[model samples]
Target: MTDSAEVPTSRPMDAWLDALSQPTGSPGGGAASGVMLGLAAALMGMVAGYTPDVPAVVAGTGRLDAVRAELLEAVETDGIVSARFGAALGLASDDPAREQRVREAAVEAARSVAELGRIGISLVAEARTLAADGNPHLAVDLAVATEALEAGLAGASLNLRANLRLARVHGASAAMRAGLDEEVGRLAAARTQVERIAAELSARLD
Candidate 1:
């Protein structure tokens, strides 16, 4: 089995962690969250097999396979964006308006992270449907998977908010802040939905 913290791809898990553990920034929390999201999708695919509807199960399995692949891609993207943001922060002191460049770069990274968070939420929502309709015998597994996805979404949100805080310190435009607020609001609703699904699944398990 692959390590949960590493990207769910062909690369060895330890190889990914070797890079993540480095003092350098990229492949940090944001990337790890993406990995978790992919893992959740994998779990969702497993539980989908337990559903009574053969066609729906096949469709869910295929959908989750695609979702997992996309999430793995996002893991790489997050690392790339983090590197870019780190580079921006490295602007030489002699460079005129260096602070402005860093702020802009930071906001761009934060936006991407927030967008990934939104994607993670959507993936969870899709999984919730499958889990809700899964076999009662596997209810606990479904519930655990939902919780794992929720935790991953929450982690992504934390990273996004941290970047946004930096952007605020750099005096981000009011409109940009408003856009972030709206994104966060949407994530909040998704969380509530997951909680309800988890509750329903848990009730069935009992």
Candidate 2:
């Protein structure tokens, strides 16, 4: 991990873009997915902000802003955790202790990425609800949020799959495997719902 002291909180957008464009492994796919999800939450908040000055819209916007903050923090946390997992993998092969550490870290990383997907699913559902009942003029904004949320969830799934492969190779516990499968199922269902809402919004636009 880039020294614990160097864990970034919030950098300029251009700086983040620059780092992601480089061939570095610290802020890889997992971090990118978190960032996208954070952006999606921010967009959802924006849509809510533009809706009629109702308590529900106002409260929902605040919650979306909180989700945005949490996801942005997750982006940094994912980078740090993945770097630690990478370090564990680089330990001497003959060291049984090292192998065990790697396995445990791999499982933890998978769990963390899966949580990101779970959070994205919540945002997707919220956006769908808003689109269904909120101001009609803001349908496009909600649709954009839904699209971004789905993309982020799909990206998280990719990261989750890779870490899951590592967990399988290292023989994760049955409970752990079952929990991960449940999360995956939830995400898949959420994605389906988001797609249906998106299609309905598209038809409205047409």
Candidate 3:
């Protein structure tokens, strides 16, 4: 077991799972989404490693390295932001500054999750590309990677929706708020594409 001060990623698998099993709302859905994204990235990198001679594979692997790093980092930061968001919500309802506090925390939380969702969604195109060009023998790994990306996208989008609702779109410019729904729709669409690809690969492999 890792020290209490360590983040979830720093802990051994069982310890991290135990922490997640606890009632704490943090290291929750958003963090889980980030982890899924990280998994997708790592798997993609492995697929790319099998075809390192391809220029595109080399470039894509480089990008995946960055994505994986960011996703893992977000796993910790998002958890912290979520914990703060919950704390803000738990403040006494009658507090004079409750509305402002909640709104700020909610926006922060929403933005954090929104960023994670966007990062996951950004990789969908790369995943599709890899499905055809990467090592054919790694099709199963590609399928799993795509599925993980889809799950990450779905999870992050749902978490974003919840945070947006909690804030009632507060503190956002009118245009930003208006576009939020459209962004969420795009995430859903991207995830759907990923899911379809994964299913195709699974069927072919079977």
Candidate 4:
């Protein structure tokens, strides 16, 4: 079995999936979303590379590569942050530091997913452009990439929503809470847009 603590990039698919399936929340849902985002970026890079005739499309390969690297790095980072957040929340209610620990964890957790959401959202326009103009032969790949991007954004929003509740309970400031609320809304809108793009592409599949 791949150690749950190991980064997803280091393990076999089955082993990583096994670790993810366990009750342990270390490589929790947020980490899974990060992997999804990374996968989307990888697929986008392939589509862009194959589109040699379009200089703009080819130019996007560099950005996709950079995004893929950052999102994959986030996969490991989110796992660690998730584990920390879980540990802090697991502290006994009566522990003198329990409230403070939970507050800090919730803040960290929210920030992690918020950043993930932003990075993932950044690719939405690229995916839409690729879907419309990339090599027609790679439509399936583009559609699949859109779906993965949608799923990643959805997961980030879900995780962010969960952490917001924790933050509210632990007394995060209203201004910060409002910012996260806007994040959740933005993620949902981006996911919906990608979902529409995916559906349109899928409809065109032979």
Residue 16, candidate 1: Cα error in Å is: 1.1
* Overall lDDT per candidate, in order of appearance: 0.78, 0.79, 0.83, 0.88
lDDT tens readout by residue for model 2, 1-206? 58957877657877878877886556778888888888789877877877766666666877788788888878888888887888888889898788678778888788878878877877875676587666778778777877777889888988888888888888777776668867777777887888888788878888
What lDDT tens digits, residue by residue, belong to model 3 across residues 1-206? 86757755545767767767778878788888888998999999999999877777777888889888888887889989989988887889888777888888877787788888878887887787788688889999998998899889989999888877877844545554556667688888988899888888788688
Clashes (backbone N, CA, C under 3 Å), per candidate, total: 0, 0, 0, 0
Q: Which stretches of candidate 3 lie over 4 Å from their true place?
A: 1-10, 169-179
Candidate 2 Cα RMSD after full superposition onto the native fold (Å): 6.4
Give a tens-digit lDDT track for model 4, residues 27-145.
Answer: 89998998899889989888987898987787788888889988977888888898999899889989999988888898889889888888999899889778877998899998889
lDDT of 3: 0.83
Measured with C-alpha atoms, the lDDT of residue 53 in candidate 1 is 73
Per-residue error for 127 in candidate 4, Å, reads 0.5
What local lDDT does model 2 show for residue 14? 74
Candidate 4 least-lDDT 10 residues:
4-13
| Candidate 1 overall lDDT versus native | 0.78
Q: Give the TM-score of candidate 4.
A: 0.90
Q: If scored against the real structure, what TM-score would every candidate get?
A: 0.83, 0.85, 0.87, 0.90
